[model samples]
Target: MAHCQFRLVNGPPQRYIADGVAWVLDPAVGGGGALRNLGIHGVDAALSLATGKLGLKSVSIANRIHPGPVEDHALLVLEDEAGALFIVEAGYTFASMRPGGDFEWRIVSANATLIDHGDHVICATLDDAAIVDLPVELPATRYRLFMRDTLDRLARKAPPPVSIEDYVAAMSLIDAAYQKAGP
Candidate 1:
């Protein structure tokens, strides 16, 4: 198996990586828990969502990204499955944010490039093309109950070949539903 490379970008305080595991940063929620690094395996398939919870609200595919960053990065709308929804930009030029999100980002993949921005994430590059932004939103904790619900829906209706075309189409459906729920 090929492992992805990762490099820490920037933050207020200096960050630390635990050799073969995750990135640990001081958390602000309570007793300063460390925000562990979740690598490629954590995002390989939808199942990774369960192990590495990157404060994801929901997952969706986008058809077009107009007047946004990156010619074609992931266009994700941040919505806490419980309620709160915000616009999130991923796979863009450099920055990505939910505007008012709480989760802190730490690149874990060996080759995952942390572009100097808040709303974007770029994985290993292929020749001159890179797998840019994987736009996703932060769902409320309530999504915990609906994990199987959403995951199953995606799996059952998943296209046969796991290519870009099929993946994007499915993501679009989920994205549409999220939009209907409002931002």
Candidate 2:
């Protein structure tokens, strides 16, 4: 029901890791690179929404990096138990920021299809196929939303948005990806 693409910004100070970054996107410093780090979230959302369960019927991952360890580009083709497909493309090799980078997620169900196509979020119907673009501004700062949600949840004595089980499920998928990313 859902698929998304994430584009990693490759700039001077933000791109590389010499002393620091906002948060290290490197495998050596941050434990996981783009595939295992960024790709997991999209995968989790897709699978969670499609099946309401973390278990995937099948998962195939491919690494498209250079002659090195880090995976700068990766694709995950996943199928849920209900026979829904979730294609996740995560990469750091996005060419430029001109006209905005390609970063979005979409979910298509029997009745309606919801899409966040970087510039706007739209809802399409299956019956009439009418598209209704929503007037919603995507957050500029990524951490701000996470922090606010976490604080609010803590104050309300509610569980975190992402739980330990979610982490486990995501890691399992990553592990499967590594195992299948053959030598």
Candidate 3:
């Protein structure tokens, strides 16, 4: 792929409450915000599609709306050895009522560009403006599916779908971004 972009934005006013506490606003409790909570998925997705070694290009993090120890928004830019660019953006900044928030995933390659619209994907050829809609089957609740798969694997004595190495690699990137952003 020449370029890949993912955006996970929410409109919940940057505060996550559970039992009368906003634990997500606490850096120590939540580890970090936006990037750590939401952008990690994007990082994992990018890593899955990487052709070669990838390196961090830049990072921008902020808590413009809700000033706290944790950031409410983050943006990261990465580049692979093949010169492909990957951008991941996460934020609690949109204005919507949806609990899951708004999600966008787009991939641009030499032959075509694919834009994910939740239930369908639009593939447009680089040579022509023609587009094709590809239907996809998605679960209404991804968390439920994930939990079911995890439990099934455990029952079958199978290894976890996501390995510790994968988690480490993704977290290392996020740590680097935080370090680059500085205190």
Give lDDT tens digits, candidate 3, residues 20-64.
Answer: 557766779877888998899889888878877679999999888
Candidates in order, TM-scores: namely 0.22, 0.77, 0.87
Q: Give the Cα RMSD of candidate 1.
A: 19.4
- Which predicted model would earn the best lDDT? 3
Predicted structure 1: lDDT: 0.32
The collision pairs in model 2 are none
How well does candidate 3 score on lDDT at residue 144? 78
Off by over 4 Å in 3: 13-15, 18-21, 126-130, 137-140
Top of the candidates by TM-score: 3
- When superposed on Cα atoms, how far off is each prediction in RMSD? 19.4, 3.7, 2.3
- For all candidates in order, the CA lDDT equals 0.32, 0.62, 0.83
**Candidate 3 — what's its lDDT?**
0.83
4-98, model 1: which lDDT tens digit per residue? 12222122222223232122332222211111122111132322222322234553433243222112223333322333333233332223333
lDDT of 2 at 87: 72
- Give lDDT: candidate 2, residue 61: 41
Which ranking of candidates, highest TM-score first?
A: 3, 2, 1
lDDT digits (tens) for residues 85-126 of candidate 2: 777666555665333345677777788877776568899897
- For TM-score, candidate 1 versus 3, the one ahead is 3
